[model samples]
Target chain A: MKTQKIIDLLDEFLGGERIKRTRREQAVLDLLDKLERKERKLLEKLAEPHDADEIRQLNLKLQVNRAHQEKARQALESWAKTGEAEKSDDGVAI
Target chain B: MPACWKSGHCLATAAAILAGAALVSAAAFDAAFARIAAGAAIFLFGMRFMEDGFAALTGGTLEHLLKRFTTGTLRSLLFGIVTTTLTQSSGLVSVVTISFLSAGLIDLAAGVGIVFGANIGTTTGAWLIAAFGLKVDIAAWAMPMLALGVILVMHPARGARGLGNILAGFGFLFLGISFMKDGFEAFHQAVDLSAVTAHGLSADLLFALLGVVATVVMQSSHATLLLLLAALASGQIGFEGALAVAVGANIGSTATAVIGSLGANIDGKRLAFAHLLFNTVTGGAVLAMLGPAERVVEALSAFIGIVDPTLKLALFHTLFNGLGVALLAPASSRIAALLIRLLPTPQAPGLTPRFLTPAAEAFPEALNQALRLELIRLYDNAVEIMAHGLHLHRRILFGAEPLESVVERNRDVVAIDLDSQYVERVESLSAAIVGAISRADAKPAEQAEILRTFQDACLDIVTAVKETKHLRPNLTLYVHHANADIRIPYNAMRLAVGNGLRAIDQLRKEPAEHRDTLELEALRVRFEQDDREMSGKIEAMIRDGRITPRMGMSLMNDLRYTRSIVRALAGIGRALFGEADATHGAAERVLGLSDDDISRLARGPS
Candidate 1:
């Protein structure tokens, strides 16, 4: 998720080093915050002595979260630098 | 065949009939039968006494002898003769050979040679009976021997007590022989085996059957041969019947090995069958050439200036056994091949432990060694799974490639179904170990204790695999985190486990004798040190404002996962590869986390 420090670090390149928050960036933060909370809660709920069947499920969740976090961080960094989020082949700024 | 009897009855019907015959025969040959039965009982008791003494005295040096000196078939054969002579138990010697053979300590040829030599060695009992038992006034001599033997047997020390047992066995054997001799002398007046001995093939076959029945019932060919010899010397049985009985005794001796090898490993079963085959074939050949064998025995008897019929029988016993060896020794390698073909290594579906075969469970040392070997396989599988869990391949960890490079290139996450792997490898192997241990005939509390430790070791490995499975997802997520604050800490955790595992893998490959638990304990200590450094790194990163309080909390929880993976692997290594194991009981405690130390560590966060 995009923390305040990350937002400021991005704004330094996007808005001439000024501390400003755009509506688009705010939406991004809100969505990222919600995702992070959901992932953390899910992780906490999945208890110990994880039996044979449950391990794969746990691994897939962690894998997707990690991949999503990395992709999101990259997009935010690019948006802060060039006033545009990175676009995928489908033209979605993910 | 009877409607009254049930299946799996063994020889219950035959035994009942034998018992009835003995009761019927008692009235006619009452005095002599009484002395012979009492003597045979005493003789059998002495054999057990001597066996216990030898075992207590020698400890585990027999394993060393099997490991080192058995370079060729001849040496192993000599070893068989010498050991059986000392212990007065061919069955014990044969079982030990089978144990060694199954464990791959000695090759199959060496094992075959030893069994053949044991056949020859067992004839020494017949010689003892003939030379000392029949001719000498054993009752008077035995009294002093029993007296001396009791005093020594009462001694507190191991070797001394063992010596006492040997002396006691000697005394009892002589006394038993005297009783049998007197019984035979008395019985000759009432009945003679010649009356029943038919001419030609029927005579040879009938008496051989008698020999087999007596041995099977008594469970001792030595006893059977001794009885036959005493009966022959006292004119109760003809020389031809004695010869047939001698052949039967050879065939009968294999029963012990055969019964023992049941439910044993493939190699053990093969060895036992080999034992049966050798004796059966030898007996057949001797019967085929009975006339020639008798003439040879008579010639040798005259050359040695021996007039006693019992002595001539002893000479015949040695010659026939020697003939068997001479016939089979050249084909020892071929016999091994034949045995292997007859009993191919079993191939159960899925995965089973290669080392924990029924043959390997023939004796305690072999059983323990096989268990250790299987546990090692479990560890190797675990290492592979753990490497995959951390987004790296086993090759990357075990190979010359840098661990960092491998982790970095692991951008394309490899999918590993840990559940399938566990089911196929760990679970199956663990169950096999438990089953093998449950079946292990390795006697006494110490052997059982070793197997228990192995079983516990298997549990530790399974638990280790399970822990790593739990840690996998978190390890994968954090190790490649977006922020350097989180990324660096997680990587450190991964590296800690990776390094420890790699170190242990190297240590595991070391010769079993040199691999020390202390070294494994040191690796574990370093794992703890790595944990402390990671905690400090996380704290410093938080203070620098690189990560939020929430991020720091996640790393803390994830760090515990990483720490656990390392701990489980360490636990496995300590159990499977401890150099100071009881097998090396004779050696001084060198270095390793002593049981107390490991217990303290297990108690948590010292």
Candidate 2:
């Protein structure tokens, strides 16, 4: 209740209210989670390929999965090595 | 005049005589009437400039505040009071609330609460005038303020100009009060208004009527209260008569809100009606209990301390408005429901603009926000049509079910007239949005750019719908084809589009902090690869004689259309849900993956 009162006071006086950017890293985390899930889903679909046509579709989807996963992994590595990557590249991290 | 009403010449002659008589009376009391008239004019003018200046300075800050704070009825009531007291114009608060209502930003209950609080908030103006305006030689202050205001008004910064206008507004208000006080004192010397003051209930009712008329003509309760203060200060009107007039002024202020609602939506109308209901009921109840109310006021004044009559009048204003809020606030929800039942939303056509209203257009911030929300509404409609054209149930498409099974289950083409639906739903709304944007006066360059982006989103949505129309026939024919080769690819296309729709829908629902438009951009890159792979596969099939060239050609064309549809949908998503902050959005755009980068990642683990 005390915290809420402080927030309300700030909100009243603050001219342009915006969501805080303290949680900017959350976008990277969410994307990593989503990419992992997509990779798993693609692997499951490719687990029992019946024909070349089906294999090709699975291959293309796997390629997409790998492309995104690789980008997200690189982003995660850069964030861990130096937080500068996260600060500078919102779109790339995601 | 009554006898001559039927004949034009007689009416004209009667009007001339009445005009002459009024001129003679005005000449007799010219000093008093002229001062009063000039003062009222200046006050109203200052109020207008101040409202405009605040609006210009705040931009969309007020809208954001309203959205963030008005979470409940009580909160909204407090918000209305604070904003109105700070701005010194209940009309500004009322108009902003109505605009929010028309834009569907705040609900009717919250709006009713705000209007209730505004009534109480507006009483603070009377207190300011009574406590300070009557005591000071405010015209002395007006000169310096007006001089400084003119200098700042010439400044290029909007903030400076806003401050200048506010300063000038206070100056003019003080000067107007000074003029009014002088006018009433001089008028009292020439003519004894006390001799005309009648006693009893009839006189009270008559004074209340006079108050209502004065407020209605000026469209400002504060002005009416000031006029009453001047009269009472100079013994032009009795204390009892001033109280009745204050009650009437409260009721009359609702007329401004009603006039503002004329261009608003049903919800705006409901809010306006709620304002009228609260004031009228409070006014009527106060009228019935005027005798007891006066005694209570006198006792409260005595208990507080010995007070001047003007200060006592200010207390009465606050007390009565507070009484109204106490009486109506608890019943605000009931009043909202009653308003809703009284003003049912008209059954609009499928393509009618929900968020676009003339009232919203009056405020540029409201206009831009309304147009964006309307575009979102249009996108929702387009999504429905596109889902149907793909023979997918929107309920299933947007549900938690896997799209692979969902697409297979919805293979049988639903009977739908794509052309008619597109024209009626998508095309008409798209046209309306474009027309509104074109007709809108984009004064701020930032608003113009935002509007242009919305215009682009509209085009992308329309393109997606058109591509769906083109892809539907081949999709419906080949999804269940006997040939495994053709049928499997067709199903792949269907699954791809369904997955795209679901991703964009989820992105739309994702919280701001978690949302990432780069994902959509990445999807666009993936769709490009899919188009290439499909083209190559179709070419190989045709060369191998697994499928006829005609079949291969149809598959190629449909594949291209499917890719177009996906790309268009992704474009719409990126435009709508991009980073809200301009700097952050620019960084995001710059950091977005280009086609070559996607290719390098897709080729291998390197």
Candidate 3:
């Protein structure tokens, strides 16, 4: 009976501890999960290049992705250099 | 004498009296004209000589001071009064005021105050004539004053020579008035000239019209009024006729400002309109209340214990102007607004653009204010040019930019038809400003720095055009890389240009007590630091294998050119504020940084 009471208490504690995320937060989590899945697929495709045409197509896609990443890196770099990242949401910097 | 012929005899007697009065009136009118002509000649000559002399003596310093200090309305009014008083010609003051307005040196309100003050200052001439010439027997001192004047003219000192010329002019003015007065007296004694029996209002209007025509012809109200005074003194014309002529003279004097503002900017036109408004309004008001005005003059003369009729006329002139000023003082702004509304038009083009005229340079107080506006323009232009460079560079770097075919064709079409004309206009304006500064008595350092800054700006524009010229064919890897590095130099140029512009504006606008040379020095330091950083970055990219040596060299050249451009801009601020030494020290420091050190610094972190 005491063990059963402890299990009930633990269940209540676990339920209380479970995160109650807002809709926006849940959407962000879902997007991350999708991105992780896409990243895995892209890695698989990159490993299994068949013909020259396919390789070329994959290379182009990779180039586009890399360019996007570089842009993000550059934005962060500039922000770090200028200390202007704090005001990014406001679209003004000093 | 016969009883039956009594009616016929009364008619003949009345006709004879009328005929005599007509003859007298004609003679009086002729005498008045002659006296006026003589006085006008003397007045114009005296005024011309005195204006030139004052200008020479002051060496533009007084004008510079006036421009520098008269930023506000009250100060401007006082400046106008003081300057006109010193120069002894309200017309001269008005011309200078118009020039200032044309040059974009002063605003509308300040310009109005100066005009008001000029009117007050002009009264000094009449007072001098009335008080010293009419009141005191100046004959005794005239010869001595003339002799001293000649002696001073021959003196070694230029300033003394100018003063001597002014004194000599004054002597000549008094001498001429005396001669004219004598001529009138002789004419009066020789002929019975009186128009009192004629229809009063008709005669008054005729004389008033004559006064207007005479003053317009001579271009001097003083001369016209002096003639009226001579006519009154000679008993050729009654007080009513003389008063009407005086009123007309006021209207006619405004023609000078109108003529002076012919090709001036909007500000000049506004000023001319203000003068017209003041004179017309005052003259009309006084004429409407002529009866009351005459009584007031008589009462003022009685109160002042002035028994002479000519003295009464002079007192009347003084009282009228004083009362007009008193009434108009509070209404000046409203009057100015109305005048501006009446003559609303853009300033005439190809005439100093109202932004670069020497009007502000004429007064020392307004000079800095004018300079501040100019610096703002310079800053804004630099910012715009830097922004364009950034946009172009970014497009070239990220995008697969098309070759120059269609784009070049379009640019060519725009350039040939529209852009060329606009560019030419700006170029001409810049050239004119340079020419004006060169001709002016500006400090050498200031002149050199401004010219250099303008040249650098022009060169930057040329460089941008040159780079964009062969758009498609020159899309080499090297070219793309060069475009990417353009940002470093462009940003450095922006920092330097902004700092320089701000420094100049602050130097000009800040109060004397708040101005600090160290502040300017610090700005120069920051500009140099940015320039050094840009140079180091280009070198570091090469050292780190991110860029080829050729690419680094090209980037270095651009960075060097940009640094030089920034240095020139800073030089302008330094020149204006008399801080050339600080710029020189900065140049030396930049030179001291070795190539090896610069390369190592450019490498950033290990």
Q: What is the lDDT of residue B265 in candidate 2?
A: 55
TM-score of model number 3? 0.41
Q: Which interface RMSD values do the candidates have, in the order shown?
A: 25.3, 4.7, 22.0
The alpha-carbon deviation from the true structure for residue B604 of candidate 2, after best TM-score superposition, in angstroms, is 11
lDDT tens per residue, model 1, B436-506: 87777654444565666677667777776787677665454455455666667667666767766876777
CA lDDT, every model vs. true structure = 0.65, 0.71, 0.51
User: Compared with the true structure, what per-residue lDDT tens digits does model 1 show for residues A1-94?
Assistant: 3485486547565643223324444444544554476568558757666865366445444434443444446545666755433233335332
DockQ, all candidates in order: 0.04, 0.04, 0.01
TM-scores, all candidates, are: 0.43, 0.44, 0.41
| Ranked by lDDT, top first | 2, 1, 3
Query: For model 3, what is the alpha-carbon lDDT of residue B553?
Result: 70
In model 2 chain A, the worst 10-residue window by lDDT is A15-24
For candidate 2, give the lDDT of residue B260. 56
For model 1, the superposed segments whose C-alpha errors exceed 4 Å read A1-94, B1-60, B96-107, B134-195, B349-606
Ranking by DockQ: 2, 1, 3
Give the residue spans of candidate 2 off by over 4 A.
Answer: A1-94, B1-63, B135-196, B349-606
